[model samples]
Target: MTERQLPGYRRIANEVRAAIAAGEFAEGDRLPSVSALAERFAVTTGVVVRALEVLKAEGLVIARHGSGVFVRRFAAIRRSSPARLSRARWGTGQMIQDADTEVRPRVVDVVVAESPAPAWVAEPLGLTSGSDVLSRSRRFLVEDRPVQLAVSYYPADLVRGTRIALTDTGPGGAYARLAEQGHAPAHFTEYVRGRFPSPVEAGGLELQAGTFVLEITRHAFTAAGLCVEVNRMILDATAYILDYTFDA
Candidate 1:
């Protein structure tokens, strides 16, 4: 159906989405009261409520316990994957996330350990099942809201005495440290999918019910064709716009 011919709730939702796109209702801006919107749209309060539910499901707005609905503050972070992974970024001591949205996420809750690789992790790293790997895990937060979880696994023997195994990988992160060990990443491959968050993932990212996650597994390979690292990233799907730019 044409937009104007849509049902009352859908029309309201479209108008609100358009207003948000036009920047009329900015991030964290409280939307008009349901009664006000109902009056303005000549619709019932129930219709307004349904409209708001539509926006909430799309992650465009959030409803608080005591306060009214507001535009989601952490919505739609544009993640330019190619740019974020470029050598120029990490090579210059800049974080990969710097290439994301203007808002930079704080890296928090870092944990480094050596553990036997899970079957899924070991195969990608070209290691035998049960091989030890250096695992570095951390959370990415923007404005104190957790948005991402990342874990990098490297062959333990290869990075045992290296900075890659430390909490702080220093300048350029693990890739830079790998360069010193003659395993610089010359290429990367990423596999991405969307799925419901596991209970642990939902808790870690503070995601609302019905929110999905983008699971990305990235493999860094040296020029010699050796896979040096396997990094798994989990991002709140609603919080990111995954941009992949390449030649046609």
Candidate 2:
């Protein structure tokens, strides 16, 4: 059916969705009350409620128990992969993440452990399937809302006596420490995909029911063709904008 021929609720939802996309409504802006929307659309209050439900499921708006509906306020993050991984960013004691966003993400709940490599991790690192690897896991937040989770893996023997094994990798982070040990990352490759988050990921990210997640797996290689680090990241799709720029 055409737009005008669609059901009442669907039509209302389309109008509201378009308005939001056109910036008539902004983040955290309260939507009109149900009665007001119903009056404006010449429909019943039930139709307006259904329309709001559609927006809520699609993550465009949120309803507070007694405070009415408002545009979801989670600030979107722009991630620039090449710049974030550039040597110039980390070589001068700057954080790689600092390159991705103007507002820095707070890293929290960091955990460090040594474990047997999973098959996926081993192939990228060129290690035996069960070789030990040092893993560092952490969560990134913006405005107290969890937005990303990451785990970086390195061969146990390669970082055994280094700061990379610690929760705090000091000034420049992991890539810097790798440089000090003569295994600096000379180049990088990233693979990206999207899917619904798992239960654990959904909880960690505090995602809306229908939101999706973006997975980015990055392999860091040294000049000698050795894969020194494999970093896997999970991002709340609704909260990210992936920007990749390259010269043609």
Candidate 3:
């Protein structure tokens, strides 16, 4: 459908968003109060609230508790699958995520634990149901803003005593470290999809309403055709622009 045929709330959001782009409301600037906006738009406060909600979801503005809604200071990172996944990126001890942002990305809230693999995790790691695996979870942040959440699984037997089982994979990250252990993956495959975030994911990314989440799963396989690692990722859609390039 055309934008002009959009709902009232969305239409208002587009106007406010355009104003933001036009510099009428610069980043980090406070927006007119809901009541004031309602008076100007000749609509009720509820209408203005809904319109602002739309903007919030689009990552155009954010509502601060005890303060007010203000334009967001956001920088969109480019996630170019080809370059980020090339051996040049991670093989050199850097990660695909690090290349996506200008500033170095930091891993936070890391948790490493051994647990029975869930159905989804099991199949990816080629593990039997109820088989144990090492699970590593971390939040990747750029410039102090959390942009992605990642969880990876490896068969307990494969990473038994490797750094992959630890919080710090130490130099070269997991994939490179795996190579050292003689299980280097020569091929990688991943699937990507986009959807709205659940409450939990939204909270983790500090996303406002109307935002969508990009879900990605990567399967790493050794030259021997053994699936060694399965990584699941969730990204803040509004914070990224996915880029892909290849030869025909």
Winning model by lDDT: 2
Tens-digit per-residue lDDT, 115-148, candidate 1: 9999989998899989999999999998988889
Ranking by lDDT: 2, 1, 3
Clashes of each: 0, 0, 2
Best by TM-score: 2
The TM-score measured for candidate 1 stands at 0.81
Which portions of model 1 miss their true places by more than 4 Å? 1-30, 36-54, 64-67, 71-75
Q: Tell me the alpha-carbon RMSD of every candidate.
A: 3.9, 2.8, 3.5
Error of 1 at 6 (Å): 15
Per-model TM-score, in order, reads 0.81, 0.87, 0.81
Q: Which prediction has more favorable lDDT, 2 or 3?
A: 2
C-alpha lDDT score of every prediction, in listed order? 0.90, 0.90, 0.85
TM-score of 2: 0.87
